[model samples]
Target: MSEIRRFAAEARGGTPENDNRRVKDSVKRLQATVVEFNYLRSDGGRVWESSPLLSTCRIDERSGSLQYNFPSGLRERLVEQALYSMISLRVQWEFDSKYGLVLYETLKRYADRDAAQPWWSVKTSELRDLLGCRDKLTDWKDFRRRALDPALEEIDRLAEFCVLVIETRQGRGRGGGQVVAVTFQIERKPKEVAAATIRELEKPKVQRRGERKAKAEDIASTVDARKALHFLTGADAGTRLKWVKRAEAMGIELPKTASVVENLARWVPQIAAALVAEERIR
Candidate 1:
């Protein structure tokens, strides 16, 4: 390969000088860029896992020009056993929402066929961490509306997946349970790059037994359950006990022998409403 002209992505504070004749604007470069990568072992062996391609990178001005340097070993890996892919610069420039960016990369994890699964489950708490909204967007509904839904909409519109769906884990005896995890599905992949990705994905997954599970607090209960249960019966011990039996009779199953709040928070308020209606009619 031969060298070509290099220039800054944007001009460095190229506006009129201020009253003090000192440029008030600061010139800063983006901290990161997205890259898709493939990995191979020393003997040209396939590594069946998608790896994190983003690394510490910086732009330096030397010899009156800009230079890009990624962390050590990154260049060697790319040269020896890796290939990289990048999306359009305009696409990167136009993305405004942090949620959209978080999800866009998450979906990239499963963007290919054979190599990457079409759908994958990640813990919701892990997703919160990935989105950098940890501790801030704690409420599920608010997180979904303010960050997740908008991200989905924007990514579905602009990104390669075209459509991405997120659903809570529901199966076995776990239906209507707290959303401890999220499953992601992609409707379509980018035609331009997907062929290469699918070819890479044809490699088998490198098996490593017993990966550590994500650390999340046990989903002991829901907020609705607490208020509804309190409303169903007053603070009296006998009343709450009788109502628990009544709730069970209504097919509102609760986690057996869990904390009182845990049991109360598992089901909806329909059972309580039923008791209220019966009392009113009498």
Candidate 2:
């Protein structure tokens, strides 16, 4: 592709002749046309083939612009040029990930103490590197283990699945046109993550002691399994049964012939156990 550069300046000289001469000389040296091609036509029987060399020459007594068209394939050339640019970008990204950790940590510290930077300005190479390292460690540990661990196996399986996709894509015609489109996923497959990204899409669960506070303090001790059962019985039986029938009619998959009192009694121990460690249940 041909390189194009433009030269224009404020009319330092006094006369229009000087201006015209300078502009004419500049245009002549560039091998460019001063007149619009669309306006000019062949005289008599002559056929003037358009060279695709177009130019716009603005000659104001003060200052103006000189524009020109070089060739037809400029757009394709531009797109090809972008491929090299993106390659350079990917290289820079990898380099940034390896050596920019200190810079990232410093910026994060500043953000913690000061105003937050705009999202566009916040670099993510270091955080990505940290997460990648943690995942690699997790994989290494899994690989060395004797048993078939589900979490480790899931990671390995995902990796192999990706490799398979890549291989299949490469087998397609000509260039590997694997323009894989990715959407932001919540990373729910593993059901767990290391300390870093774990906070991103999930939060640490908080445990509460089994106690009723404030207004319910007086009734807390009395709200037990036996009392709960008696309360259910004393409540309008017809009303409770009607509510259950309504739930079934609404296509809600509820346990049949099971009262709320019976269901709560059966599940209370399990629910309490899950809320805290078994040793902490007391």
Candidate 3:
């Protein structure tokens, strides 16, 4: 009950401190909450168990303080995972307008890159509620244009990571197809904190998993090379060679000036020109 109350508070945009505090007060008020479990026991017997999900809860009405305890390590882990789908860079509130902010927070929850995939799939209804979308609630195309696309643009431009969103439809014929889900991929850029490093998310509407992974690898290599290339272009010729030698000694496969100049991706707009001007082109 307390956990549900905390979610309700969070959905209504309460501060984290308040969210935690409310759980305690709310839990104490609930008559009882039940927890059910089914698992193998240590003695080689399968057992089913049921207990109060909130076994212990206390509240100090005057101080407005509260206390609650979790049931088990696994239960705690489940709660943590449910609460934090993703760890994100602290985003500036105003950088994203209301729609943009909603979208960013929603996607940030699914920003788990270490997973088998780098994307999230959210049902259309759930996505709408999550974004607090009350106006034009039935219009899919308009929602995508007014809310989704602009939000994507803002998050990509303002945040450290960029994302792309696409939608799928359900049903058929007669009443027209309803949108089923919205899927998108999040890609992290270079570590340098600059707007220039933000890359556009331009994969096609229907990208295969393998292709998505290939693009990810390609983007990663270019980002790495861009870092090295940026340093080399800004340094004196002597320093550039010294850096290259040190990098080689460290067993790093760097972009030779020629390779960087000739084959660099378009995202690194400055590097190739700098190399060409310096007569470093192969």
Per-candidate alpha-carbon RMSD to the true structure: 16.3, 26.3, 18.4
Q: Candidate 3 — which pairs collide?
A: none
Candidate 3: tens digits of C-alpha lDDT, residues 139-177: 877888877777787777666667866667778954457
Highest-TM-score candidate: 1
Q: After aligning candidate 2 to the native by TM-score, how far in Å is the CA of 3 from where it should be?
A: 22
The lDDT of model 2 is 0.33
Candidate 2 per-residue C-alpha lDDT over 1-282 given as tens digits, one digit per residue, 9 for 90 to 100: 011122233234232343456665766565453222121234535332344233444444443444555555433434553222112232122221232322233222222332222121211222223334434433333422422132223222222111011111223545564322211111222344333233421321111112213425445433443444444445566644654565456554556554464553442322222222322323
lDDT of 1: 0.54
Report the error of model 3 at residue 54, Å.
18
- Model 3 is weakest, by summed lDDT over 10 consecutive residues, at 197-206
**Pairwise lDDT winner, candidates 2 and 3:** 3
Kindly provide the TM-score of model 3 when superposed on the true structure, using C-alpha atoms.
0.38
Top-lDDT candidate index: 3
> What lDDT would each prediction earn against the true structure?
0.54, 0.33, 0.60
lDDT of 1 by residue, 1-282 (tens): 012121121233244331321211111223333443434579988564332344443333243233445545455656752132354454444455788876776576566545544876778887887787898979878998999887886565456565555667554544465678877876675686556444433433221111111111112222333455666434456656766777777777666742264455455354644655554522
lDDT of 3 at 187: 73
TM-score of 1: 0.44
